[model samples]
Target chain A: MKRTQFSLGFIVRRSMVHRRVRSLAALLALTVSAAVATTLLTLYVSLNRQLHQQFRAFGANIVLTAPDGSTLPSETLATVRAIAGSESRIVPFAYAVAQTADGAPIVVAGTDFNAARAMDSWWQVSRWPNAAAATPGSPVAAMVGTRAQGFLHGDDFPLTYNGHTLALHTEATLRTGAAEDSRIFIPLAAFTAWTGQSASTLEIQAPGSAAQVEDLLHRLRAALPGVQVHAVRQLVESEGRIVDRTRSLMLSSLVLIALTVGICVLATLTASVLERRRDFAIMKALGSTQHQVALLFLLEAALLALAGAAAGYLLGSLCAFGIGAWNFHATIPPLWQAAPAVLLLNLFVALLAAGLPMRILRTMEPATLLRGE
Target chain B: MATILQSAVGSEALIHLHGLTREYASRAGAVRALDQVTLTIERGEWVAVMGPSGSGKSTLVNILGCLDQPTHGSVRIAGTDVHQLSRQELDRFRAETIGFIFQQFHLIPYLTALENILLAQYFHSMTDEDEARRALASVGLGDRATHLPSQLSGGEQQRVCIARALINQPPILLADEPTGNLDAANQEIVQEHLRTLHRAGHTIVMVTHDPEMASLADRTVELHHGRIAAERRADLTAQK
Candidate 1:
């Protein structure tokens, strides 16, 4: 059937004007819900991404520190490597106290840099150093982690070697745990020549699975009763617990806000639909099919949603930017990153609240409404 | 002398109903508005329903217009059972077969005369700007096409309402107290328009309390307590 666009236009206009206050109230409720929901969802997604990136920067799958000046045995390292769940990169080394010509002191250590690289996926490498030398006279190069670099004042530092001072090159920064950056790395040959140590402490990373690393640590600790073993599993688990709690609180707060806004929107839309029931009935009695009536309600909802979304998107982005700038001293995510997500969320809220009025649309009786019954 | 061959042939019936009963529920009790009322209204016949108040005149008009359903009988307009049709189909049937003119001139206040006329075509046909214009012009409100309901005088507003009713070109026109709310001068104008519509071969059924209004019809049906109490032909009323 042919429809007069103008006639329908007048119907909508009359309906809106008939109860101006109610219409305004509904629009306001929908707009507020959209803004709050968009802001919270955007923050949640961005924060999760940032946290994941930070976690990836720490290279070690598992690091075990042995105390009391004891070196980890080769048998323990071999058993860890042979464990079904373990990865191939496991290195052990020892450390000793040494002094420079100026009588300043340092702890010289042995490490395997190649294997360490595989464990820390988010390591932002400025440069990769040449392989460590095989003999005593070979100079060692070390990459400082962020925390260690901070401790060392962002420059090369001197270490004592055989009563002489050797200046080590700080080739790059590894942003891992706080302590990994501060230590000095030398070839095992150089460490043995300098301190006469036979074996080294273990830095094990069974990257394939956490269980294998725990198993390896367990067996070693049992064999050498006097040796102390420290793995970061406890720290990671504790941090995970704290992060989970924070996430729960954030989610609950957001959900509460969304629910409150949703109810307000629902109330407004219900009132609007009730106030305009006569207009809808007249349209139907005039000859608008059920589909047409449904579309009319849908169109109204869409118009309201479009207005609310446009306003909310602008408000949400501004809020995100302001908070990021004032609190984090960084630019918020680009529009490309945040806008699509917010738009999708806004549309979802619109359709959900709109569903309520559409249900009411289904129950409208045209004859009764026209008769003013 | 054999001049009987010049006599008129009987007119065709446009609306037919059989054993129609319409009951309404009120706080007092169930009341029969149209009680087993069988009726046949001919095409091009301007009939008036006349009776005192609560005589079921409005109820019969409502039933004939397909605005209300009969509880015990069927209504057939143009050979279609209105009672058996779906709600949407019944609405379409009413729009296509009947045009109603009410005493209130129930023009949507916000709409202009032209827009009000266009609203009649909203659910039926596509845009009929020319038809709406012509309908208003036929009712002598062509110059007041853009005026709102409030802007038009009582007679002009009633004329716009008539134009809207005729825009669909239905076979029957149902008017409920078309001049009940009009002043004497406006009533004369509205009644003249109704006569003009009848003269143009439109079937009209009107409900009014005024005996003078009833005298204008080609036939009058007197209703009482939900029953047809009397029927009068225009020729007999005219000869008196």
Candidate 2:
């Protein structure tokens, strides 16, 4: 007899349509699992970078100082500038003990106020001194730390050091929760003139991975011979440890969630296939090869997985955006790079869930099933 | 033993069974369903199998349909020893050689009448919608092609089952109480279609308890306690 071959798609469509409730139940389970997996994976990829960037706000990772009691050469700033290049913020400090009008001594530090502000952006200051007003050699401003303000009789005061005195205009009160809160900040050129000393230390804000930072430190040490360059352990190590722990937590949670979801899908698929055993038996009795029967089931699962994965990608992307916004106060765009991996993951899960059901189909006897035994 | 059974039947015989035995383990121990039963049917013959409920009528049909295997025996259909065929080959053999009509209709409830016939064709090789439609028309169900099994009457559903059975154009047809669930009127309608198929040179093995239905067959074989009790030629009975 001349027969027309019905496409496999046609059969699967009819089967799913006929058992709409069961198909939908399986599809929903797969969709939810896919969504959760995709969401976690996307967020992990997107948020890891953001977390590192947030840590960057903590402060400079590298600090450079002179060796022994000798101060860094006046030309050391130029050498550091040449090596650190334009991307790095370099602030050099020269410290001296100066006496107030009340004869009480106060520690005074000199630095490029603009660079200092940029390097320590987290510092709370009542007002920032205008770098334009300082000019080249002018001492138009000095910032009094909140603690040092109590030692000064007024906002504008004169400090004498080594018979040389400079009148400093108070532009702001710096309230950093550190040693900076107990010192005075003046222009480095003016302090050098008053104390006859150049910059003693350098604070550098350099951005990159730990390897890149170490490379920069090596370059700085080699370039400026006697200068001692060291990474600030509290800043660099803490940042590395926090980022590592967060990534590990996200990865572990992602794996755990995927496994839990996979098991749920497995249970749903098993029950769905069990309910269709009679149909499979009929197919077997009608002369369907085991391969053909198995193909039908696998094809059904693949279709459901493909559909669920697509919907999940969209849902998970939205979820990632919402979570990023809620916690980081930043919009995280969808990490499209994770799409392929998510698809592979969903396919693996769907197939794994179908494993037990396919085994059941293989071992089922048409005669026994048809007899309702 | 197989040679003896094969030769006992004429060269034109399409089915030959030798020492077929099927046993099931019960709480009371092994119980035989078909005890060393042997039978043969020629090409283009309609044979009625009749027996009490537990006399192994269904077992015989299931074995012939290749849906079950006998513990000990050889079943040859068209000179092919089905027992020796692998599982996959048996599926192919069943597809190409046999069509079955069950007592319960067994039409997938979600599918329409036309789709039910197409399903059989799909399993056989492929489905031709035109052929499926024609099969439905042949069974007087062309107008109700779109009706689901649940929406059809018992007679209509049985007719759909018959159409599905014949869709693959197999040489042999096995009907296990095809009208067992139908009213007398519906039974007559289904039997008429069976008569048409038999006249068209198709070999048919029908299991039924109705003598009137059995009277339509070329011969009737009666089984008792898993053994053949009697065999009679319907033509001889008509002649007497």
**Which candidate tops TM-score?**
2
Residue pairs clashing, model 2: none
Q: What's the TM for model 1?
A: 0.65
Candidate 2 local lDDT, A1-373, one digit each (tens): 4554466677788888988998998888888887898789888987666775676667788889998756898788888888888877788888888998888889999888888888788889888887566665444588899999989887678898987887887889998889988899987877787788888899887766566778889999898888889999777777777777888999999999988998998888777777777778778777788888888878888888888888888888899989888887778898788777777777887777676777866775677677876
What is candidate 1's lDDT per residue for B184-234, written digit by digit as tens? Answer: 998898899899889988999999888888889998888888888788889
TM-score between candidate 2 and the true structure:
0.85
Q: Highest lDDT, which number?
A: 2
lDDT for A172 in candidate 1 is 63
- The alpha-carbon deviation from the true structure for residue B147 of candidate 1, after best TM-score superposition, in angstroms, is 3.7
Q: What is the Cα-based lDDT of residue B156 in candidate 2?
A: 97
User: How good is the docking of model 2, by CAPRI class?
Assistant: acceptable
Residue A223, model 2, lDDT = 88
The residue-level lDDT of candidate 2 at A312 comes to 84
Q: lDDT at A201 for candidate 2?
A: 90
Report the C-alpha displacement of residue A314, candidate 1, in angstroms. Answer: 3.6
